[model samples]
Target chain A: MKWEYESPRKAYGETLVELGKEREDIVVLDADLSTSTKTAMFGKKFPERFFNLGLQEQNMMGIAAGLARSGKTVFTSSFAVFATGRAYDQVRQSIAYPRLNVKIVATHGGVTVGEDGASHQMIEDIGLMCGLPNFRVIVPVDSNEVRRVIRFVAYEYGPFYVRLTRPSLPNITSKDDEFIFGRGAVLKDGDDITLIATGIEVSYALLAAERLEKDGISAAVVNMSTIKPIDKDLIIKYARKTGAIVTAEDHNIYNGLGSRVAEVLVENYPVRMLRVGMPDKFGRSGKWNELLKYYEMDDAGIYNAAKKLLEVKK
Target chain B: MSDISPEKIRELKLIANKIRELTIKMVYAAQSGHPGGSLSAAEIFAVLYFHEMNVDPKNPEWEERDRFVLSKGHASPAYYAALALRGFFSEEELVSFRKLSSRLQGHPSLMVPGVDMCTGSLGQGLSAAIGMALAAKLDGKSYKVYALLGDGEIEEGNIWEAAMTAATRKLDNLIAIVDRNKIQLDDFTDKMVILDPLEEKWNAFGWRVLSINGHDVVQIIRALEVAKEVDGRPTVIIAHTVKGKGVSYMENTAKYHGKPPQDEEEYNKALKEIEEERREI
Candidate 1:
């Protein structure tokens, strides 16, 4: 897989513009992060349909639900911390409980937000969003997947929380790859072990696979983007076939892709699995790439986890 | 108020008393619901369903129909009574309120017909109502959006945030009614959290503020009628009302905020008060 990085938020903003042109009922709301969330593109195109609620994530969520009740597909954008954390109760009570058609495409998921540190880095957004009933959570891997997920959630009638990273993702999953809602996309097939990943870590898993094979361990890479209504069959299938598993994400090891994957395997087909993500702790101000390496969530992290799992397998 | 006829005033008063009667009955029967705030909001609901708003109970999902959000959602008894009287749902469904497999949820929800938005979580419904108002403007629909909020519920910061949105967007089609009954579950609203000069707060938020006697059927209807005429800005009615207005013992009492009738005597007494008021009307 070629590793050319691209902004998922940019794709989100651009895709929203395209969707706005097609569907007149599609309205966009941003809580003062339109430029960063890339919702400014849609706002620039459709001024009347766009609302900048100005640092009011909680109120913005309620507005999103209200518009949805009135038969409009509403998309809301903000940093993940404020989007999911600040307005969690609003999302839970207003959007998720009623099952309104509001898409909360939060940018800056995980520690990739960087510099702003622990407060802005929302590593638990996926867990928070997935905990709610009627909320379908997705963390798109790259720019292509981001576009597809945004477009998909618009037509699908329900509440959605699509997590995107602040840093552009390295191109790993191609545009041609089929993006299914509740199914994991296997980027590479291998028999030795399966490397399951999501969001920015999908590219890291693919990159780690290259290093793993050179170390004589053939690794399979699967992008488990949909966190809720997770692809249990895929996890079970890969768990049985490989006999060992390694999960990676840009989120916490708890209740994220790893925890979810472990839950599925433990109930169905248990395997020797290693979770490669942040230890349960807060992150400090640093460069995002340096932070990824410091947290050991880069290619070397997945590669090292795979080798350790293989040793245990032996 | 003069323009509203004696017959129409008499009918609205009867409906308001009926709403109060049904509210107390529903709460007392459930043995687990709010009656104080619901009682305070009875006349507001009565005027909305019976006189003020443009809506069709037969077609609850009518796109052009005016929308209402019960922002202070625990007050479902009064709202349900008004909707039932207006034919949104059968009075039989009132028994199922706050029950399992019942469309009448503890708070207003989309499952119930004529409930424009699911609300109960304080301070959020106004924003949803603003969304409905904004949608109407986008679609070029003339239907207005109304939301009933508790004075206590406004203590939530989200209400202020939502207030900013309503005025910033100049949502003239939006009108919010604050059930200023003066008592919350814990204590009188001023004792719990001072919300005095509340109208000035809404005024500072750039809303067209109206103050009226919330319990008076004529005043409630007249205020609502005035609210619709205000142009280019949203309206917020600071309706002065007594907590637990109808029943003698419950009036202005905090205990009834989350309690039902304790005994048959209390229930019958409450019922008699409601019935006597109906007779006078």
Candidate 2:
């Protein structure tokens, strides 16, 4: 199957412009990275609704909370590292604790931020956001999914953290794929083992499933977009059916997609699981694809992990 | 400036005294809370709630009502006293402060009526106020946002970031009153970290700076009135106050910043001091 590619940030920016046109209360805030985060697109169309907070992520998060309290649906953006790490306290206390209607649309998630390296790469944003109570964490697979997620979070009245990558992701889901909050999408169906993935790794999971199919193995692929409020029922259904699970993501395996899945599986149905992602270490300056390959988050890595997991199940 | 007559000043002073007495009682009952900053800002809170801010207790979430962010949220006892006196909640709720299931947490929570933002961490309220002010400007609302910051709390780098943003955005409808009480948790602010050039700093950041005795009801009212009159930029009134202003034993002492009255004797003495001050007013 042929695949298209689009930058998630670009889709997010374009979709925000549309959301702005539809809802007068939609407001955008960026911490001096409006252009990089693609929020500048919304700023261009509706300058009055956009706030350039100028390199102050901590203040930006607090301001976003205040705006939300004043009855405005606010969308704030910055690099994932700064948005979640630099201002974690503000996000937790002001936004999450209060359960404000604010959407933190962070870009440049994971090592795919490339060349900017360990300093800019945020491998633990999911873990940090998941720790906060009342925070909905989402990592769309591609540009098409990014558009839908943005629209969904805009209308939803609660605090959310949606991460986007810098590199253009291969289009996995079509435009018609409806995004349901707290639900996982079954991209492929099989009976042998389940491949659960999020963010850019969803496409790799699909490729791995196809490879496993050729090896006389049936693999199922589930796109777990919303990390928090995770789909427990779907996960249990797949665990009972597949008998084994393989979780993959561009983040560290400790507290990203893998940990979240493990948390669900441990309580409901214990199963043999393999998590394929960046090891417990920082990333270095390299090309985006190089970083993925080096970190063992590529399709080949997923296939190898799945192959090993199948052997464990047998 | 709005002319505050002598009679009005006397009424505001009594309100300030009530707030101080209640704040002392709340902290003493809880036996664990900040009383120094709370006592120091009683007059400012009294003036804002009674004279300056356009707020209605019956409608705490009124769309056009003015907003206040207590940045130095450890001073929540003072804030709660003012809110209760202004009829935001029953004055009886003051005793339940910092207790389990009490609406009055150790820090200010929006769960309490008339509290705009949840601010306990220092140096965050100013940014929230800037956000509210910005929202008002975008929606063409006439509501103003006021934030109160502690002298030591300004040491957080985030406050400067927010101050720079407020000035750059020209938030004319925003006013920040710094409770320059000279003492923090450990010692005087000057000994801990000098904030001597405070007024010059706000002026350099493009704010209309006003220096006033924070305990003076008439001066606080006048500064707030002046803050509203300033155009195209935010205003910051650096209010010089003594920590634990109403209690002679606690005054200018950092020991009472977070410590309650040591025992029944001290508590009684503190209450007597506050009552004597009220009688003088």
Candidate 3:
């Protein structure tokens, strides 16, 4: 089926402008990446409540904490590397320790950030943010889900980390779909094996499951958007139903959906699993699609991993 | 400066001495802490809590209350003493400092009643203060934001980033006070990382800079009062002080930078010196 593509950050920018209209206390801060992160949309509409902290990621996190403490639900934007990697200490001490009402909406996560190369790509952000307490992590599947995220966090108090991709993705999620925090949605149920994914990889996993059906294998696709307080119940439910599992993500295999699902199953229902993600290595200058394919994260990759895991079951 | 009455200075002096004495006792009771910095910042805490800031300890989260952040959070002994004196919490909790399950962690935590932000890691508080200042401007509220940073703590590059942001936004309602006691963890900051011409540095960053004797209650008050008048940009008060202001044995001694009195004789001598100063006031 043909699908329309939309940028998640673009949806984020539009939704934020709409939220700014209703909430008098919503403030946005950006660290010189507003243009790329699309937070410039909110800044242009609400200049008084917007702050461009100018390349100072560490200071921006600290400032975000202060704004939240003053009873304003603050949204901060920067690249994945700069927002989480550059200011880990600031985020830990200023935001996470006290659990302030600040949302960190970082754009350009994973190797899909393209010709900017490994320097701009941040596959470790999921692991970095998940390690912190009092933080709810989410990697929205599509533009519509991003819209739901913007509204959910605006009214919800406490710290949050929302990761968005650089490339625009197909709308695998529907507009009428409701987003429940810390819950996963089962797109397709299968009795043979389950495919768990997040971010832009959700679309890739869905396509992979479609192809798997032709090979006499039943594959279930799940969009595990909330990565920190992961849907343990849903994961365990599928683990009990399907004897084999395959986890896919745009991050490193060590700490992404793969590691989380493995941890959940190893404790509950042990199963044969293969993680489809970037191997623990760096990427060079290449087109985003080519880089993803070269790393074997496309439908071919998921299908191959699913076949191999099922073979191990035999 | 002359308009400020002598009686007011006397009362602030007494409070400063009490803060110094209380800081020594907290560190002594806990048997571990950064006493030198706490003693050095006693007068700054005294003036802010007693005379300068418009804060009601009973209503700490009052929307209109002036906000304060102890950016140099290792000086919690002085901070807790000032907050206790201002009637935020019971003075009896002072002995419970650094105990397990106590609100007072080794560094400042928001779990405490009057702490506005949690800041133990250096060079992060000024930005938090600026955030509060910016929020006040967004809401059109009149409350000012104050943050106290240690000279050593300012060595972290995050301080300069916050400095640029404050002036870039032209936050006149924000005031950052540097407890310039000249000592850091290892030795004097002058010997480690030179922050000299610190006044020119602030002026270059577009801040109105004020220099004063940090130990003098009158100077501390005058600088804070004058900082409120600064408009179009933030104000930074560089209050110069001794490593340990009240106690004789600990003064200028790097060993006491993060240590309490070792024996009963040293603890008694430290308390006696602070008590004598209070009596003189």
Pull out the clashing pairs in model 3.
none
DockQ of 3: 0.90
Q: Write the per-residue lDDT of candidate 2 for residues B47-164, one digit (tens) a residue.
A: 9998889999999999999999999999999999999999999999999999997999999998999999999988888988988999999889999999999999998888999999
Q: Residue B118 CA error for candidate 2 (Å)? A: 0.7
What's the distance in Å from true for residue B28, model 3?
Answer: 1.7
> How does each model score on TM-score?
0.98, 0.98, 0.98
Query: In model 3, where do residues sit more than 4 Å from their true spots?
Result: none
TM-score of 3: 0.98
What does the lDDT read for residue A23 in candidate 3? 93
lDDT per residue for candidate 3 within A86-190, as digits (tens), equals: 999999999999999999999999999999999998999999999999988999999999999889988898999999999998988789999999999999999
Worst 10 residues of 3 chain B by lDDT: B1-10
Worst 10 residues of 3 chain A by lDDT: A278-287
Candidate that scores best on lDDT: 2
| lDDT of every predicted structure (CA atoms) | 0.91, 0.93, 0.92
Q: What is the TM-score of chain A alone in each candidate?
A: 0.98, 0.98, 0.99
Q: lDDT per residue, candidate 2, A262-281, as tens digits?
A: 99999999999999987888
